[model samples]
Target: MTRLFNDPTAFADELIDGFVAAHPGHVRPVRGGVVRATRCTSDTVALVIGGGSGHYPAFGGLVGPGIAHGAAMGNLFASPSTQQIVSVARAASNGGGILLSYGNYAGDVLNFDAAEAQLNAEGIPTRTVRVTDDIASAPASEKHRRRGIAGDLTVFKVAGAAAEAGYVLDEVVRVAELANERTRSFGVAFTGCTLPGASEPLFTVPEGRMALGLGIHGEPGIGETDIPSADGLAQLFVEELLAELPEGVASPKGRRVALVLNGLGSVKYEELYVVYGCIARRLQEAGVTIVEPEVGEFCTSFDMAGVSLTLFWLDTELELFWRAGADTPGFRKGLVSPRPRVSAESGVQKKPSSEAVMVPASEESRAAAPRIVAAVDAIAAVIDAHVEELGRIDAVAGDGDHGIGMQRGATAARAAAHAAVEAGAGAGSVLLRAADAWSDRAGGTSGALWGVMLRALGTRIGDEDAPDAHAIAEGAADALAGIRSYGKAEVGDKTMVDAIVPFVETLVARVIDGEQLGDAWDAAAAAATAAAAATADLLPRVGRARPHAEKSLGTPDAGAHSFGLIATAVAATLTRKDFAR
Candidate 1:
């Protein structure tokens, strides 16, 4: 449980500020995250690594010489926004191409892939290699879908070292992919972690029991069993990893592997050492040679009492890179030669201005702008009221941050809409600005999808005139199209798409039948509400919940629930005197 915090929402930002102040020699603050304080050769590829903020040392702390050159840190348990990733990558780039790597969670994949595409379009070459090392998350045939865990270090280290050694971006990507292919991890938790300001843990194991196949994002484990002895746990880890060797490894015997016995927060280092002792003996007896075994917290949940074991089967090239020197805030190996500090004027780049050139609006459109602002405000209010419940629902099978993420996005959207309205922007412009702010501030799968939805609708409802029922319905249809295209989730996938699809279809049908805007919206909102409730009977087929699909059987997806709530609130806003047809 995180006890000390002024505001839970501000924890990630405050910690980054303090972290930069404490490690000035290792890292410098940038707009989205941190970059190495030291200078690098112009030809050296920049390795940009990151994910959510809770995993200390994983992201920001690894920004230095032979680790990540920069880290695009995001909000607690949320992926960094695409804008943040680009900002950090630009700051870290030194003429050489950039390599982006991170855990293979859904949010991280979406944002990082977007950033990679954006950077390439901007003429800054960039590529990505998602780390998929948690064997428990997926079957061997579907290894590409596995979640990254402690094995993130092995991939990051190899890629960072390759970049530091002046490998080209393509070469860096190759070795990183190889490292990811060879790595495997498994974990178990005695208890779940509680996020800041939360009264209870996200998920809990019964007394005298432990959860198996735990995720680092406070997601509940896949299964539960009686707590095992230290030696018993060690044997369990070794056997699980040994059962499925990487391709080309005929057997575990005679293999030289880099082992990481990672403590997931509240688990003590001494406890890890106790387990590692037995693990080491077991491996030695099996004729396996362990190299550079690390025993401590690498990636962690906030305060989860758990441990994970990672086996990085090292080929000769990987072994050399694995032993390479690194000088980062959280990790160091051998000795790195001193490098000059980056010039004060260099590194961090100015953020692009959010203000767009305002197109003149008709009197009717200007008059309708206030209603749009009100709708955004209503969204914020609804999310704020239901945040706790949303988090609880999400904790059933996913990280319990959906509520916080939606609150951040809606609050930011509300503020941005107000600012746009004050600047004399019309309805479309206000929504466009709000869309950008929501995505930039929220920084996750939900955030990205919301941005897509809002932008699509805003574009369709141009500033030339006040939108009628037909136009609003068309815009909503466009939003639905954009969301489906961007998120790649369908109606039966148990995502927000389930609710969104029905809402858009109903709204379009009602408007086509000549219903007024308010009446049509009310009907659509009701459809969405029913669809959201119906999601409880359907298992999640995508995103973080897929690994623990059974646990989510009785709980509706938080995204779908929140979307339903927002649609209902927006219907109320449309029925107000200012927005009435």
Candidate 2:
């Protein structure tokens, strides 16, 4: 959702206009959406950069002191036209020389190369440097086939430094080529990006899986994998990228590397740390000292959910250029980092929800109508306390928003109960309406399953037939059959079935003596506890969660626990008279 611009078609112009507007003293706009630094140094070689839109600062924002002399901006993710690039080349060229530079991709090659040839024809001598750093793109024998990712920033900096140091255009281009030779990148995608005005993803990836080796332009990846933890995913990328590096590849004569922890688009800085932590450890383990690690959104694809790891093998020369002072809107040499004085002992801690399985218990004829309201309130309170925990569990195995789902459901249920109370609705009617509200607000697998059980209870208690013990038993049986049929869940499947089976089995047995509802509820709760405990033995059979399904064996299913608690709380407060409504 990079919507700071007004028009999708006019994105290039709008973006360049904004850049010039923000730094009036630093840059001047050229036609075809290019911007050049206003300051002049005709004696020095000039650096010219160009790229498509959405990769900010690579071309435009980087046009400032110690960076690019000019930038050519293109339509959203579309390569700049030959004319657009040549326009910038003419403006950025100093009297001494001009060096053309850009990331390597098919469209970029066509546009920038055409511009370079056109510039030479016009008698303005120029040299071009192409950046291609993504190692996953091809084997070493075909390294030229790799795509340029975040590594372009480093390549541009080296080229710019050469130009700024009064080197000829040839020398600047030569240094840019050397930087490209040593750089490599790898990336993983948790989600895909949508092009502006397009409804579907630019690339396709199945839900709940990360696409490995994907490029910035929504290109296909080697494959998809499930990542349940940050550490696990980092290992996969680092180990695979380093395995086939050519001898003499990677920092100072291959002794060290600089890292760019780049967020492609929508990934947050908070989540980036999880990946960076693992990457730093792997680099240290491989005996590669990291000179300077930069973490931020330098390269992006219009809110795509991914990140790329780029390594620069530094020599004394390139290391000096890296350490040289430079500032761009996106690329900064040094930003404020708070001192790492650890006063903080930190502990750090997905999905549509599933349904709850509920069974009715037979109760003796008794009077206890006044306490039902208190019981419903208690049930809502229990749901509130576990909302955050439930969401965390779902995120691990599912879409990672179950906490939000549960909170919404609990809030709606409580509101419904209060609304009914204001209108003088009775205890049974309040529970009925509250359950309906929950079903309407919470629309996942969990919602429907729980809804069916609550509806069955309200109907059974509200019926005029005065259901006998056997009638209530039959109702409980119906609820069980519906959940099994609808959710297609099986016992020991790591689903609500774990808690549900025991609760129903116990209630069915207790009905024979026409037990009081409160007493029957207590029995069912005990059974639920035991059943949930038993699940510690089974591995997960579903939910697309990786490796942890084995370790999750000891933890109760969050969905099942929620189901049991709600049912037990309801049954414990109602008597035979309470069922009369």
Best of the candidates, lDDT: 1
Please provide TM-scores, in order, for all candidate models, with all chains considered together: 0.98, 0.56
Q: For residues 274-390, could you state the per-residue lDDT of candidate 1 as single tens digits?
A: 999999999998889999988998898889999999999999999999999999999989889999998888757535645677778878888889989999999999999998999
lDDT of model 1 at position 4:
88
* C-alpha lDDT score of every prediction, in listed order: 0.91, 0.65
| Model 2 Cα lDDT, one tens digit per residue, 409-495 | 456667776776555554445556666665544434455455556556555554233444455555666677767765567897877
Report the CA-based lDDT of candidate 1 relative to the real structure.
0.91
* Model 2 error, position 96 (Å): 2.5
Error of 1 at 18 (Å): 1.0
Model 2 RMSD, rounded to 1 decimal: 21.0
